[model samples]
Target: MARDRSRRSARGNRLGLVIVGVVLLAAGLAALAVGRGLLGGDLAATPLLGDRTNAVLAQQWVPYVAVAVAFVAGFLALRWLMVQGMNDTVGRLYLARDEAGNVEMPESAARGALEQEVADYPGVRRARARLTESGDHPHLRLALTLEDDADVAGIWRRVRSEAITNLRGALELDQVPAVIRMSMTAPARNPRRSLA
Candidate 1:
């Protein structure tokens, strides 16, 4: 019922994406057929594309319009490709509290809060987190960037302790799975003084 609405099932969005993909796929096939001269020759039937007759459709504006449409298609295709590769993460984390009331927080919001808290430590440049669901369970994954001169071992230990305590404690969960990944910033090149 109403409580079920709180969790982000991802079903609706996933179905919507599937529909878009199918439409794009149909459009692509049509474009391919047109390009391959399947519609007879250099001329093609383009309803709403221009005039119905072939000779009238050969104006200079036609090719330019085609090019513009192609550019837009390319952008949409790129965005679709990116979306295909990324993990869908719109799930909400349900938090237990001392009171009997039900509480839920958006996964992105929790990640943002945790990322900011982790960035407070020295040597850590920044942090980003994501929450995703596996079956009925939720997991927190972290990506962190460190300064060139940062202490790896010490910073890692601190990060683990703080992440576990703050995250699990706030969520009121006895256990929360985490995945931590770290990357180091490249060292800055020193500018040499000119020798007079």
Candidate 2:
């Protein structure tokens, strides 16, 4: 998915560069025509204001140079804008690995650890965990499947408290926000069994 987004962003950058290039090329041609009097203008007189002919000729180079510089700057700006948009669109799809060696655990290992820690509580049938980033802090979200006869409010309170406690202890980070979401509640089983 990241690769796909990167490719799309690259394509957008290329398109923007092409547009800037075309604009610069057109501006260059216009500048040449205006400078050389090919656009049906007076050739002998000063093209610009003031009496400094040498300065005016030198200043004539400014428009072409400005167009080239503007083209490059505009292309870079458009590329940056497109890349930022792409990052925002796909940023939440994957978790960033922590740079700190101590916290650089495998994603599966972190999820498994969180799930095991949360599963010991009553009314929890199953649990899945994911680690995300909120600025510099690691954010954990746990989705718990509850038992059939469990009290939802009680389970939620217990799970939420237990999850925060365990995550803080394990990660040793007070900035973490551990969230518990109820994903499913199983249905009660029938006592009668049919033999076929």
Candidate 3:
């Protein structure tokens, strides 16, 4: 859920930036046209700052207000940048809750179990798993290193059918979204065969 929200937020941010960029571009073009006399307006003769605006800037509190606004904007920008590096990896999650109290499980246990299961598979050199979001609806990221001669498609199918299924059953979840990344290592040379 948190991952989805983050993605949506990123999308919205991009959309806002695009909109702002387009508006600024159009305004600049319009200003250029006016300055070139293409649009019947005397841009050079117009005062960049009006008398009323100058009076507001001349106030004693203006500098303080400007500094405060600058600080606030800087803080918000920093926060946004930090958020881009954030991940919603779950630490602990509630497996069950009732009058008997809540049954909690550390997310690392689940991740370890899943990794072990995959690593035990034939031809799989190594496996790693990460659980993200909430316990009720979690997302899994799996990374697998395989032997050069490993059956990639077969292993993929088996993981989707067995490993993920077992994880879902253990977590008592209806569905667990997962992403698997697989890579093959260089083939090992036969010891008995001498290099010519």
TM-score of each: 0.52, 0.42, 0.68
Q: Model-by-model lDDT, in order? A: 0.76, 0.67, 0.89
**Model 2, span 1-196: residue lDDT tens:** 4346667978987898899899999999988887888876675244456667557657877889889999999998888887566422112222234565333445566567768866877777888887665334566767889887767898777656766676666655665656567865646466677889
Going through the candidates in the order shown, the clash numbers are 0, 0, 0
Give the winner by lDDT: 2 or 3.
Answer: 3
User: Which candidate wins on TM-score?
Assistant: 3
**Order of models, best TM-score first:** 3, 1, 2
Q: Which has the better lDDT: candidate 1, or candidate 2?
A: 1
TM-score, candidate number 1: 0.52
Residue range 33-98, candidate 1, lDDT tens digits: 887779767555544265556675678798899899999999988987786576746567776545
The model with the greatest lDDT is 3
Between candidates 1 and 2, the TM-score winner: 1
Residue by residue across 1-196, what tens digits does model 3's lDDT show? Answer: 5657878998999998899899999999987877777866676568778999999999999999999999999999899889878777888867898998988899989899999999999999999898987766788989999998899999999999999999999988888999899999977665477779
* Global fold similarity of model 2 (TM-score): 0.42
Using lDDT as the measure, what is the rank order of every candidate, best first?
A: 3, 1, 2
